[model samples]
Target: MDDPYKLHATAMPLEQRRAALTALAGKIRSGGTELGWQVTWNVDYGDFTWLIGGHINNIGDPFDDNEFSSETKAVERAVLDYFAELWGIPPPHDPQDRNSYWGFLLTMGASEGNIYGLWNARDYFLGKDLLLPEHSSGDGVEPREPVLLYSVESHYSVGKTAHVLLLETPADVGARRYPGQCPIEGEWPQGVPATGGGSGPGTIDVHALRALVEFFAARHHPVIVVLNAGTTFKGACDDIAAVNEILAECYSATTGPSWQTRPGNGGRPDRRSWYWIHVDGALGAAYLPFFAMAPERADLESGIPVPAFDFAVPGVCSMVVSAHKWIGSPWPGGVYLTRNRYRMRPPPFPEYVGSADTMLAGSRNGQTAVVMWDFLARNSYETQTTEAVTALRLARYTEAKLTALQHNSDHVPDLWVGRSPWSLSIRFRRPAQDIVDEFGLSGMRVQVQGADRAYVHLYIMRDTPRDRIDALIRRLAEPGAF
Candidate 1:
């Protein structure tokens, strides 16, 4: 048979195309149980099939009405409002109100949101009047150069954003391309190092972070810190509240040249300090609130502690969450939420798009908003909280099962089964290649007791249940499976 995945200049027969698509769908369905990534496969988008064929683009800000009538801005706004309520922010009453929440749908997942947040932070620290560029000419006290700081466990997007924005780092200062770009005049890691000695496996040490911030603040440099609500590999969350406390202390102690103390453009207020706190909550942000709301629920009594990472925390300026991770979207998409006061006043409205281009992407995916709205509408708060608790329970079950298997004398030895508190992922000894491929497991190598050991993790998403975990255990029990 000809390869169904191959494409040619000549069009295939209609019957052949149908058969090829059917075969591909069958393969996906057959392997659905083995999907180990963060993506949730228990979603049904049958009701949205009709809207898929239309070219509905959400052009600009969700709250602002644009001339593009074919967009789904209303639905997008509803989605943002839902998240605002979840993340403890007041919904926007008016588009121009600075106190209300402001945000937009992202077409390119959390990476786009991360980039957007970092860009806003960089510009905000630079004191550039984005709304009126003409009035920003050498105004007020010269703003201190901003330095980028993030945990070593942060998503690769944070570092990539720093490189793209040309933001200074301790390691990149004396390099070949841009010399002396970093203002910090001492040794520092490119990324803030994570905590060691098993206090918090993948979380950043707040003390170390405070020391670093003090070092930078003393040198008259503004700071931008990216906190992770859920790390990629270990699924650990940083203590955002503690970090906020550190920022408050630093703010009180530091006496530096003020950046936004004088109104340069748009009559902005007198802000004494320059700092930005962004949370990359691609996984945890989507469900942690639900966990917090229903901590006493029967199934969620696993003793896993939930950390706060939302607008309620005073220092958090911006946050992003992936729809595909916990909310189960078909494609990579998300929502970026921040207060309207913190939003960078967008450049003059573009007449071509017929709306103010406040978001990162001009032509956003309208169908994504519909899909997210559908999911949220179909699932109530109670339903979502139950589902979140179920996922956590399954993760605990997997960890317990794997630990049992490790202790079994006839089965694998030195399994190194481990899981973090409130994490939906379990890490253990790497199984054979066939098992890894069949289960869609992700592998990593780390130093264990001073010896390098191979590890693989399984994420307990919405669709992953005990039966699937049992099947994985059965495969590992086979002779020489590891």
Candidate 2:
């Protein structure tokens, strides 16, 4: 009698367990009400909630054969086609042409997309095969190792990807202390000195970027430029158009007209593009397209100051965007887009899968694709535009409130400052740790010029209401509230 019930029912019964789960759900919902993170993009999956049942795996390429799971591929393609149009990748005409774009749903958020995009660029430029005839002399000599150019404000994932790919060492000063020394563990020497203006905390300084690219191109090394579209910390966006112009001036100056028009018997583009520009638009990619002019408007006279980080920029080779950021998917997933010609050779035919292993991960998340598709399908451009407008409006409103507080509040004189006009993050001096914990605020310590300053960031995402901002501002302005 003592053993019969004890061993079989060590845990609570179903009724009791359900009650505990209900309690947990109430707590989570209460916590969700206080959600303050600007990077969090939560969505209501509604009808698509049924997709969570069973094992849904998107093995192999999304556009190619999917031996494991084929049901989600069509939905995934619709997602890609929508983004391709948004990013300015030309639609495929005839099946024989490589004019269309190629991409896949990434399972591991933007980090995976970043690595995949960089890997493609590395292989395209530094791989054994040469796509374009060199502008410089290189008949028998090997090309210099490709150099990665990104602002100090770029996401940490960029640096991590570089290290993981053995591209460069992070924060390692190789030859300074010891003469003729290489980094011990894939660490590069110190990076370029940080400058002010766009180079400060968010955006990239185009002049500094140009100088770095020229420094590398002068030595015959191909360059990969990671342009930030809405940086992680301060929500800064690099000048993609300016960067493109700099590429034309810095990297391609040595070549003549025929340098790009190598007599390829076909009517394809010549190899004028010497370097690659990958837009890390984890936050802004989904948001900017709403403000941009319709793709048919070639003159680009939209009057919107939005920076072009898409195919409209001739030098841009690829872009990585996180659906989990602004697009509001359930899980961490993203989209990686590149030209059809620039895609790396996939692994040899996997007989079992009946498709080449082109994507970064083998067993992809088909459910994430469906979630994204549901979100995208329900929200048209008009709906997204309305939401984008509201978010930015609230962001500006929050900044104005903060600025007023900085001017009036005695306890906090220099309270808040906004980044670029297009940014959504409003950074200010850090408040008490209790408030930070209460509101779920994110903090960072950054070095500006010579001084180290602590700042708290608030990202004004879609769901963030005006009342929430007002409440935070009021709490921040309260007297004796350090």
Candidate 3:
């Protein structure tokens, strides 16, 4: 009989695990694996070596700081400045915002970065302008609500901020667009209600976003539009420029008989009509410089490019990217960059600039800041192109395999490639819950999420291998694993 706890009974000692993993190295290759995500939970991090969990491949972890040195701080600033120069912008500001907070800072992940963008956006729209009545004093200004609008495809952090940040914020704000962030568990709701029965802007379509912006502007509300540069699971980007143009056009619309027009002939534009677009680029933003230089290959879904999202785009206000995922940077590591440094739409600062906080995560790893610079300095187009091509090959390969499985198994639905070149998802005929649990046991983890139960995602790379990937596919296709 099996032991009381099969896994514990079968646990491999550290030395044994090292040996087993050392032997498996030949079988594993980056971007070719079922083992890549597995390695995430396996590899542990200490010193410069990353050998977390059960996985024991010693990937170098450059995002560490062990000392307090002015020279190192200077190096980080210089490197960040260098990156900012690459963007054709002023040098990146220190997180301390010494000179200005108008640029970028390293983050723990794109999720935290998105939260940060929303927090700033909320202040810009509601708090800073005396939009809230309590802040408006002798000016006789009544506090008004700032509405946050985004496609459902936008990062969850937006919603988190809506409930988590704005709820604490003094301004009364609500989320519009498709999926409203109003509390589902509570009563009377809060903020703005969705216009189209909350079906959400369908499929990141720009037209839907345009219509929503117009509807809200008609109410004279301050608005901020968030665009998904790299949606979590699907990896698609919203057409940002088109969305901006739509909001701008609506802002200029002058109609509504003689009465509907405001005191200034209603032709006077609502400065608040100027909407912001913060790209939630968790998995994709770091490769933007690469995309900016080489648009042809980079624009492809399987290639790395900033094509549809970035600060380079005229209207994009802010963006975030995850270093922990593709870059192998340690946890709680993400970054945010913004073109607007001084424009605050929220409270506490009527004349707003960037936050004094270096990151939304305060007292953060100054060490990671140095290492992030190192990664960027060492990151080259050549390495990215190689990684992109490999990831694409595996994604395309898995697509074919999963598609064939669908034909044979009626339960397995259509398995499609993700929106990004570097990511892919597989949909099975069976329930995603079962699939999730099965993968857990095998240490071949994937996600069964993204607002759909039928389609499950199998992200490739980091440290996974082709053999494990094949094994996962085979097991999934078999009768029992489902």
Off by over 4 Å in 2: 1-36, 40-42, 92-96, 129-142, 169-201, 255-273, 293-304
TM-scores, all models, native as reference? 0.90, 0.84, 0.64
TM-score for candidate 3: 0.64
Please rank every candidate by lDDT, starting with the best: 1, 2, 3
Prediction 2 TM-score vs. true: 0.84
C-alpha positional error of residue 23 in candidate 3 after TM-score superposition, expressed in Å: 20
Q: Estimate, for each residue in 303-382, the C-alpha lDDT of model 2 and write its tens digit.
A: 44677789888788889888777877667888888876566556577888876787788888888778778878788888
lDDT of 3 by residue, 1-482 (tens): 63322345666677766766775665443323333241232233354442232222101111223332322344545555654554445665543342232533454567776777777676655434312111211221222455677655555577777788753211233323323432332222332222222222213655445545565556555467777654555555566667766766775572121111121112221232245677776665554445445435544454434455655566676767666666665555656666434244322321222223233543344454555666666767667656655654676677677667767886654544233433433323333455555453222223333343334456555354567668778876766554
**Between prediction 1 and prediction 2, which has the larger lDDT?**
1
**lDDT (CA) per prediction:** 0.79, 0.70, 0.49
Q: After best superposition, candidate 2 residue 191: deviation in angstroms? A: 4.4
Global local distance difference test of model 1: 0.79
**Top candidate (lDDT):** 1
Runs off by more than 4 Å, candidate 3: 1-72, 82-101, 104-107, 127-144, 167-203, 254-273, 288-306, 343-362, 408-452
